[model samples]
Target: MRNAGLGSWPHRRARMAPKREAFSYDGVSTTYEEVAVRTTKLARRLEELGVRPGDRVSYLGANHPSFAETMFATHQLGAIFVPLNFRLSPAEINYQLADCGARVLIHAPSHQVEHERAISLDSYEDWLAGGSEEPLDVPVTIDEPALILYTSGTTGRPKGAVLSHANLLWNTFNLMIGVDVTTDDIALVAAPLFHVAALTQTLLPTFIKGGHSVITPRWDVDECLNLIEGYGVTWMFGVSTMYADLAASPRWPTADLSALRVLLCGGASVPDAVIHTYQERGLVFCQGYGLTETAPGATFLEAADSVRKAGSAGTPVFFTDVRLADTGEIEVQGPNVTPGYWNDPVATAAAFTEDGWFRTGDIGRLDDGHLYVVDRLKDMFISGGENVYPAEVENAITDHPDVAEVAVVGVPDERWGEVGRAFVRPRAGAAVDAAGLREFLLPRLAKYKIPVHVEVVTELPRTGSGKVLKPALRRLPLAPAVSPENAPGR
Candidate 1:
């Protein structure tokens, strides 16, 4: 009596607001009715391409209307959607495609030459011309796999986190209630749709409410401002770094961002300065925390707490149950949590406890039910038997006016088992000296927690998701103590 597959959401949405604008990009708008109709034709075309129920349909392209359309179409046939990051190398993309044993590949025209297995998004018209627009009567249920989103896997080889239709739906509901998404909301999908946050938090919830969404191939501050003013975007989600970049934009002050009611910040802990900047513009920057395994909506610092609990990731979402493990690693139990990695039982078993609670790998604590994220357990270091969390060190280091970005890593030391090394990126037109930074941190953090060695870099290497790659940082040679700040900016 119940149809839980995500494929049915668009059909249901069309009934509520057929003529409503469902999506827009690069001046083209598609209504709910149009999406419903086109998705069926696209589904039929995919069927013709031999994608069957439970088979994987991969998309390797930048954000586009066709990407969303293809996703829903795959859902229509009870197939799983695999959206590859366009920024990844072809080898990386091909690894996922083959790992999932994808039935077919749909990619942007520009990437088609690099991936011969993929059919260009431009060829959709020709492919669908002869296909029938019949709705598939597949037996896909809410508990079945809906998507296979690969984690950044800085800790190990990238593993596909299998998210079910139920996981996606539950997460959407959790965010809608926690984030206060409304039917009139126009959400901007600025982050890569391949990630769960931009899709589950922004796109899915808005779709269910018959709201509007704008997709972009990449994140651009100027174009984002244009969309906010032009489309009347009421909500958006970005990493703390992205928010800082926008605050630095020349047009940010006068950009008519009055329509933006909620700004969701995640991926990393936002600095107090970035929060204050948006508050000046009359907006509440909601900070959140989650992983791909949790469908990405585990916690959200409410608008009211944006200032009150500036550094916290906030309370757990409605359905998520969060607790601290004996070792301080965050553990979560919820319907939104992923079942496990695809086809890797050993890894899956290792991810959860015997009682089935998923270990988050990141060390954190709860204060009155509000979660405060510490650094990753693997990234934590022991200096002469004392625990050193990198996040705490980074927070203290960035407090200096000259510091722009910073990453702390633990390296092997002969005296101590491991020691902290600080890499600082100075703000533009600003200068920071190791001697000055050492004096600055002396007051902010415990002497033992301070990095033994300090170095300056123009920029820190980051993953596509905006995570600092500590592994890459570890590869750089470290000096005995203070290395003079690299004054030359890249």
Candidate 2:
């Protein structure tokens, strides 16, 4: 196989296994050769449409085989690929498309009505139907931008992080150094391609190894389990919430999960219980941490340390540097670090330090070289002059047997300035109330760290990648604050 480099993945795959199955979805299979051929044609079609080097080609769709094809095609033309989160509102999507100045927008047939303002690649299927099966020769520099993935932007408008071809290529190599993947391996890609976690961490790595990718349009627990069992899937990656749901499902133990080898969980703090549950089932579960700015992967929990370093995001991946500011913010610098936010120099300058470290905005600490994420610096709050980190509080609450999921936020309080409030989702078939949960947390957390108000909810708002939308929680109404006379320890 040839060396890994920018615009070299498809070429490498074609040489490694031209006729081998590269992707499968809904009973449709595309070989490495076919993918290469289609992508080449798509690139020509894009060029005919006036897409030039540095132009952005945006895509809004669920996980599908075409999504991968479009990504490779965009790279084939030296065009930037911008993937929009399907979960975002139309207005939010419009803002991103306009912000990126995308010349062409490719979307799923289902989203055609919602995104009709731009040209659709699906509509031009016939144009791409027949073209040169030969590969389109395009030159790409290592420093050239390959993709633009928007941050979740829980606090403000999302920023477009420009990931260079070298950024992604090196990050994939970093992942391969840690995780052993082979051509015989089959990866289950249930997460959305819009996020770097799914794109760079899972899909790109699988492609680099000449492995097969099994894509699911969306996350349906039963469907995911069925596909894993039927396709003999060997690897999978998902958010902590997805892992918790799969572990808690009644069908999990009975399903043929024996084929599954590695399960990666990230995007949020993972509960210890979820890790233990998967361990009991003989599945190896590892935690990973990264941001869009870092090409999505900076650290990974090694299999040897999976249990010993439970709840930790582990050490930085190869070629990545991690440091903590005096204020406790985690700063990262490495090849995988993004060049900058596209067309937003002011925000881009603000995201980095004078020394060139990218401010992750996440507060964490390193213990003996292992990274432990505490909470987002923006999520930290002050109540009555006391500092509180929500992750610390949420961890304590989720440890409770009855609590299935929990999110902590600061709510307005007249006397204390701001107080902690928790929104909890109880375990299935478990009876839990505010008082019981509060009592359960009292001994586990400090007085100020414990939530004063608890609300039972069916579900919590989350981003496409399953991260808790704390900003949405902040907008929700909080219960009336307790009077000074009745407040605890007042």
Candidate 1 TM-score over all chains jointly: 0.79
lDDT of each: 0.81, 0.79
Model 1 score (lDDT): 0.81
Residue-by-residue lDDT tens digits, candidate 2, 330-418: 99999999989888898889899999999988899899799998767677665543446676677767888988988989876644546
Stretches > 4 Å off in candidate 1? 1-3, 113-117, 380-490
Query: What is the lDDT for 405 in model 2?
Result: 89
For residues 47-126, write the lDDT of model 1, one tens digit per residue.
88888889999987778888888889999889999998765545556677878898888988777434434678787678
**Cα RMSD for candidate 2?**
11.8
